[model samples]
Target chain A: MKQIFLCKDRLIFPWVRPIWVFLPLFILIMLPTWASEILSVSGFGTLGYQADNRSDVATIRDLSQRPKDGYATGPTWRLDSRLGVQIESRPDPRVDLVVQGLAYDHYKANLNNTITLAYAALRPTVNWNIRLGRLGYDAFLMADYRNVGYAYPWVRPPTEFYGWIPIFSVDGADAAYHFSGSDGIWSLKAQGGKSQVWMPINGGIGGGYHFKTDNLATLSASWQSASWRVKGAYSRFTSASDIPLLAPLQAGLAQVASANLPATSAQAADLLQHVSLEGARISYTTLGATYDDNTWLIQAEMGHTTATADIVPQGNMGYASLGRHFGAWMPFFTFSTYRPKSALNDTAYDLGATLNQGLRDPSVYMANSTRIDQHTLSVGVRWDFTPRAAFKVQLDTMRSHAPGCGLRSISPTLRTQDIHLNQLTATVDFIF
Target chain B: MRPLLTLLCCLGVCSVAMVQPTQAEVDVIVSPENPLRTVTASEVSDLYLGRTRSITEGGVSVAIRPYDMVDGLVRDAFFMNLNGMQINQVNAYWARLRFSGEVLQPSHLPDAQAMLDTVSHDHNAMGYVDATLVNDCVKILLRLGGGAHVPPSP
Candidate 1:
C-alpha cells in the first residue's frame, strides 16, 4: 500500500494547472493602464442549432457547437455562441497596439468552459504588422476574427474545404506585409509556433482527443481585385504522438475476429512500429470571388490540400452562394461539398506486401483511411432592421457517403450506410 | 354645369398669366477650371457612395454630402438620377464602413447657400440645390435632364 501511494503521487502535479488560469488575467488587468489611451473596443457573436436525421448520430449543422456524439445525453444542439472584444491604441502617429479577447463554449461529455483568445499586436507602418500570443493559424483566405457569422455571406463555410484541414488556432507569433498591384492588393504572411487544434468528433468509442502541437509553420499570400479574391497557403505540422503505430494494430484486430488468428502482444507491438503514421506536411490553396452589384451579391470559393502523411486525407472542397436584396430583407442560398482521395500508401508499401497481408494481426488497420464524400445545402435570410443591426436565420442539411472497395471492403456494412443530419441557427449581429 | 366649368378654366388661365412666371430651373456645377465638360450618372453615384476616390478633374480625395434628407430639390435633381438606392441603404453602407474604419459620413450642409459655399471652396465637392440660386461663384456644368423643378412636395 505504501508503494502504491508513492507511485500515484509521483505522477501527479497540481501546481502547474493554476498558472493557465492566472496568467491571462494578470496580463488583462495590466492592459487598461499603460495601453489605455487610444483603446477601442469591438465585439461579434453567433447563436445557432443543429438537427440530425439519423437517430444513432445527430448531424452537426453548426460547427460552433458540440457534436452530440462527443457529449452526454443532453440537447443535441444548444446555443453555440462566441463573443470577443478588442482594443486598438495609437500612442503616436506611426505606431499602434492591439489586444483582443475571445471566449467560446467547448462541450465535452461532462465539460462546459469558454476558451479565450488572448493576443496582442503592433503595427509601425502601413506595410508591416506583427502579432503575438494565442491567435489564429494563418490559413488561405479566412480571417479568424472575420470568420464570424456577420462577415460571411453564408450561415457557415462549405464543409468540403474549410472542414478538411481541421487546424484552427495558433498560439505563436505572426508577421505580414502588403504591396500594391495593378489588379488589386497583395499581401504575404508567415507564422510559426505551438498550435492548438481540434477536429470533428469521431463516433467511435474513443475519438477526437484535443490535438496539440509543438512546432507549426505556415506561409500564405492573398490578392484581391474589384470583385475577386484569391489566396494560397502552405503549412508544416508535427505532433507529439506517432500515428503510424496505431493503424496496423487496429487492422490486425479486425482480421483476428474474421480469420481465426490468435491475438498476441508481440504481434501487435511489431505492427505498431511498422505502420506508425505521424508528422504531417500539408499545403493548401484557396480562391474566392464576389460580385457586389446593384441588385444581387454572389460569391464562390474553391480550396484544395495535399499532405505528406496519411493522418489527414488529401482533398478539395468548394461552395457557391447568391443573395438578393429587397427593400429591407436579403435572402440567400448556398451549396458546398468536400471530396477525399481514395488511396493511402506511404510509397513503400504494396497491396500484397507482408504488412498488407497481415490483417488477422492486431495492428494494420485505420478507420479513416478510406475515401468519403460530404455535402451540405443551406438557405438563409438576413433582415437589416436598422442601420446598425441585422438578424439572420439559416438551415443546413448534410449528407455523407463512402466508397465500397479497398479498406472499406474490410467492413462492407459500415461503409455502405449513408447518414443524413440537419442544423438550424439564428443570430442577431451588431457593430458599434 | 358645363358653362360654369368653362368659366372657371378661363379664370384660372387669367390668374396664371397675370402672375409673374416664377422661373424654376435645375443645373449641375463643378469647378470653373475643370477640363471635363460632362459625366455619366454612374460616375456621380460612385463618388457619392465613396466607392471610388478619384474622378477625371477631381483630386485624389472627394467628398459627397446630400443637402438633407428633407430636401426635395436635391433628391429630384441628383440622387434619383444616379441610382435607386433610398436614404436607408446609404445609411447602412456608412454604418458598415464606420465599424470597419474604412470611411466616415460626409459633412451635411443645411441650405443651398451653405451648399454653394462648400462646392465653391472645394473643387472636389458635389451637390445640388435650387437652380435659381446658381451664381457666378460656381460653374453650372450640366442642366437637369428633365423639365420644371418644383421638386416633389413633402
Candidate 2:
C-alpha cells in the first residue's frame, strides 16, 4: 500500500526500480552474437577481519571520518569485503570491449554496486594500443588493480602513499607504446581525462565531500627485466569542491573585511584565498622500483605532491618493504612515512586580543589541522595455500607525531595528544 | 602361503615402479618445416611467457604459438630449468596479466602426444615433450635435462 512519488511519476518501492531497469539491460548486453564468443567472466574477492587496540574507531585509510565507531572494535565484515567481476568481449584481433562492476561497502551511502571500468581497447599496431572510456589511473604501481588483493603483496597497499590520491578512474582516453629489447621490455603511457571523487566525512554518517576535476593528465614510463622493474609517473589535475564545513571560515573572513579592520582582514583574506577549493591545482610525481627473483622481493616507492591550495597540504610519502619466499610462505617487513611541508603555524591568525575568539579560532584550527607527520612500521606474512588463493596476516603500528594528523583517527579525548594505533588484519584473497 | 605373500610384494613394487616413471628429459620441438633448428633456454622462456609473440628469421616474422602440458613432471622440470619458477608462480603471473587484458597464457595440452600432434601440424607452433616421444614429424630444437633416445629419420 506504499506509494513512492518522484516528480509527477508514482512508483512502488522506488529503490527497486533501478534493479529492474539495469538487470535486463545487463543481460541483453551479455548475450552472445556471431562475432562475439561467450563472454569471458573473471572475478576477484577478499574476505578480511581486522582489530585495533587503540581507539574505538578504526582508521583504514585517510579521508575516513572519525568518532563514528570503528570496525576493528568487533568482528566486522564490511571493512574490507569486496567483490569485482569483469566481462570482456573480443570480436576481432584489433578491437575488444571490457566492462567491470564492483560491489563494496565503502563506495558511498546507499550505493553498493557501481561500474568501475568500461572501456574499448584498439590495437592499431602490434606495439601500440589505445583505450577509451572509464579507465584506471596509470600514475602509480598497482594503480590498475589495486583493489584486487591477489595481485599485490600487501593486504592493502601501504596507505601512506596510496591514500594521497583517492580518485581511481578517469573518463577519457589513453595510449601506450611498448618496446622490447634483448634484456627487457619498456613501456610509455600517456592518459588524459576528468574524474569525480567521493570522500567520506562525519564518520560516514551520510556526510561526505564530492569533488569534480576540471582536467587530469598523466604520463608514466616503466621498464621490466627478468628480475627487476622500475616505474616513474607524473600527473597534474585541477579540482573544485563545495565543502560545507569551510563555509564558517569564509563567512568570518568576509565579516572582518567589511568591519574596517584592514590588517586583520588582509591576512584573513589571504588565508581564505589560499584555502579555497575552487580551481585548485595539484601535481604529483612518483618513482618506484622492485626486484623479485622468486626467492626475495624488494619494493620501494617515493612520491611528492605540490598543491596550490592551503587546505590541501604539500607533502611527501614513501614506503619500502622487503620479503623473502620460503617455499609456500613469504614474510615481509615495511616502513612508511608521510611528512608535510607546512608545520602547525597558526601565529599569523592569532590577531591579538582585539579580535573575537570566534574568528581567530576557526582560522587557526584549520591551518593547524593541515600538518601531518606520521610513520608506520608493519610486518606481514603471506601463505599461498592454493594456486589461485592466498592468506595474509599483517600487523601495522602507526605513530602520529603531529597529533591527530595523517592516518590517525581523531577522537575527542585524543585531539591534542600524539597518538599511536596498533592494528592487526587477516585476509583471504582469491581470483577466479 | 609364504610364497604367495612374496609374489604379492613383488607385484606391488612392480606397479609402483610403473606408475612413478623416472623423470625424463624434455625436448623443445617444432614442426619439421620450421627453418630454425637451434634455440637457447632464454629464447624458449621468452616465447612461452608471451614476452615476445614472434621471432624474425631470414626476413620473415613467424608468429609463435606455445603449448604446455596440463599436469606433468616434465612440464615442472621444463619451467624450473628455464626460469627457476614453479608452475603456481607462473599461473599467478598469468592471472595477474590476464585480468588486465595484457597477455594470455599458452594453450594447455593433456599429454606429450597431444603436444606433439599440435606442434607437428603447425609450422609456427612450438611445444615440449618427453624426448622419448619425439618422432620424425617434429624436429628437436633443444634438449633439457638428460637427452632421450632419438628415432631414425624417415
What is candidate 2's DockQ? 0.15
For residues A2-62, write the lDDT of model 1, one tens digit per residue: 4684366335522112226434653565466455444445555555443434445433322
Who wins the lDDT comparison?
2
- Candidate 2, B-chain TM: 0.75
Candidate 1 backbone clash number: 19
What is the per-residue lDDT of model 2 for residues A1-432, given as tens digits with 9 covering 90 to 100?
112323322153232223335434544655653245435677888898877776454575435322336322354555566788887766555566677777666535333126666676787766777987767778887666767778767788887887546566676788988777748878889998776656654354436677666468999998887777798999998874656777777787767766666587776666676556666888889999989898999999999998776667568989999999775568999999888776545676655575536666666556556556778899999776655677789999988765334554454345456778888889988877
Off by over 4 Å in 1: A1-37, A61-65, A68-79, A107-117, A198-208, A240-277, A343-372, A403-416, B1-154
lDDT: worst 10-residue window of model 2 chain A: A1-10
Error of 1 at A336 (Å): 1.0
In model 2, the runs with Cα more than 4 Å from the true position are: A1-38, A62-75, A107-113, A251-265, A350-356, A367-371, B1-39, B47-52, B58-78, B100-154
Cα misplacement distance, residue A36 of candidate 1 (Å): 5.3
* lDDT score for residue A265 of model 1: 39
Give candidate 2's whole-model lDDT.
0.69
